[model samples]
Target: MSKIDSAERARALDLVPVSRETAERLDVIVALLEKWQRTINLVAPATLPQLWTRHVADSLQLVPLAGQVTRWVDLGSGGGFPGLVVAAALAEIPAADVTLVESDSRKAAFLREAARVAELPVTVVPARIEQVAAQLAPGVEVVSARALAPLSRLIELAHPFLAKGAVGLFLKGQDVDNELTESAKSWRISSRIAPSLTDRSGRILIVTSAVPLAPIKEAAGNAKGSTHD
Candidate 1:
């Protein structure tokens, strides 16, 4: 098995250079994940040895993709992948905030503790994504999810935040092409996909706009003299 030694891990961390304060906060989160993983399965057992590469580095790659956005909402934040990790980076930005929505009570509790211990600019919302999106305060700049749902459902789930002008940034597996095809069946969306730095089989999906195909078709049909060739 390939292994990443301390030197290698340090070099890997260099790929995304965070402020010293952000690094300290991430350290706290890593410690918490390790402690909690012993009993709660915060991460896959097979990946315990590669925690930094598999989780931390993977999450950190999303920061630059979000540009200058300061407010964020992470859906189904099971172990606070990009949410808490991103929050660590956001700590350096003024007025930054990251809200992590997790439905699992145990996971939510862990997320709360991690944020508290790390002292990150994060809010742990212990509720289903459906229940909290509408209640979210305005001006949220981005919404993200990891290993949560397919592209079609993700659009549905993130609709509230998107409607309010928040961009969507989702971490996805290699099957993303299939998911995007499925989503296109029902929705008209303007989006872009980027390769993931952490894993060859992973992808980053950024969605700026999503509208239902039904309405779009109706609008096209309603336009006077606008006929297909």
Candidate 2:
């Protein structure tokens, strides 16, 4: 891997400042990611040069939005972007933990190693989202995803947790407006959109309530074909 520019790293830290301990932990994660990238595809090749600003800072920006919530679930935690970074920041807080859900075995292994090496409080769940969503939903305070799926599909995957009152913080790009419009068709979502601190075109979607809208055809059929006494 090529060397990261010191200036870029400085800029990212400036955007989301952290204590020395947290910075060191994040450094370990970045180093481990670079080492593992040679064997497995951890992140996009083009983004490596700006990894700190693009990935690290982008992930770190979610920490503050989370407030004091300690128990977090990061869905599709590929390369541990916001998951590991959030865990690293919360490592010192009491009872603070982040669960990284990644189905790919190799990536899961990397997440485990990164958490172990950084001594961050994290659980690496190596199962598909649907397989473990129920088991992990209870007691979760925050649910997050970065570049995972469309807002509509994401709601489906995160429904179990959202229904349980866990807030959803999803990182989206320029097309977020379109995704929200698409998601509205099947879900009544109470959400707020915040501009991302790291990218000009990026946005962070905060969803507090997501209720599934009954299929129009199903409702129509029930109204026309069924009668109750």
How close is every model to the real structure, measured as TM-score?
0.88, 0.92
- Candidate 1: residue 3 lDDT (0-100): 31
- Residue pair clashes in candidate 2: none
User: So what's the TM-score on candidate 2?
Assistant: 0.92
**lDDT by residue (tens digit), candidate 1, 4-113:** 23443564488777778888888788778778876786766777667677778888989899999889998888777878899988888889989988777888899899
- Which candidate number would show the highest lDDT if scored against the true structure? 2
lDDT of 2 at 137: 98
How many clashes show up per model? 0, 0
Candidate 1 local Cα displacement, residue 175, angstroms: 1.9
Query: In model 1, how large is the Cα lDDT of residue 77?
Result: 80
Alpha-carbon lDDT, every model: 0.78, 0.85
